[model samples]
Target: MSKSQGYDERLAVPLRWWAQGTMLVATLWLTVVVAVPGPTAWVVTGVALALLALLLWSYGDARVVVRDGWFQAGRARIEAEYVGEVAALDAEQTRLVAGRDADARAYLLLRPYLHRAVKVEVVDPADPTPYWLVSSRHPEALADALTALPKTR
Candidate 1:
């Protein structure tokens, strides 16, 4: 039998972001087409399409997956043994920890659109990072999974 996943999520960009980006791209296309005209108009449309594709691709890259005794956020992954002191943060606290009172050594996988977050401490003595501040729509669930990890070296 296979072990079940503890936590798995893709942190996607908010719909409003996509809407805003599309509006911006449309405006740019209009400006280019209006100013240049003819074949240049088609070039402008192609550029707009390319820009939108790139934006979506980049924004969809971040993910939080907790499985196989590992915590993966964005492009970084660490073993559960090194994880400690998971704190679920509300919008206000998330903002404070992620911004003003943030630790420089900590790893951050933050998305501006995500207001809730979880802070996971790194207990590895050799590692300079204090904790990871990660944006999560389900902070409590993520925290619970982190807390459930067995303490080990």
Candidate 2:
């Protein structure tokens, strides 16, 4: 098991995705070189590569963190006091929850690349969102960290 820094996880895309993306960019470079065949082709390929890099970096920048009496998934956060009933979901369970049994008002921090997730119930009655479904590579660890949080309320 990994040491818990209060359960911090970055949802990075797999390396295979990077490899495939790079190959695609190479293909784009080839097409541009064959069609245009000048400095314009180099410029076009460079811009396309830069854009691809930026998109992948931004897409993988999302994070899930639980620390200092708070839980966060991507841009959304909630106090630990308001969190309840954390569950670690396997691939099948996550698919079912995210697809068949999803609540309309639930806050989901889902990534297509991630198949496992953690379901966190929101106990705050004032909040409109019912629960949070956050994708995690290590869902059990995340659930354990969340469960260990001290609820002030």
lDDT tens per residue, model 2, 1-153: 343568899999889888999999899999989999989988998898899889998999999999989999999999999999999999999999999999999999999999999999999989989899999999999999999888898
Each prediction's whole-model lDDT (CA) = 0.86, 0.92
Off by over 4 Å in 1: 1-4
Clashing residue pairs for model 2: none
TM-score (C-alpha) between model 2 and the true structure: 0.96
| Poorly placed runs, candidate 2 (over 4 Å) | 1-4
Worst 10 residues of 1 by lDDT: 1-10
Model 2 has an lDDT value of: 0.92
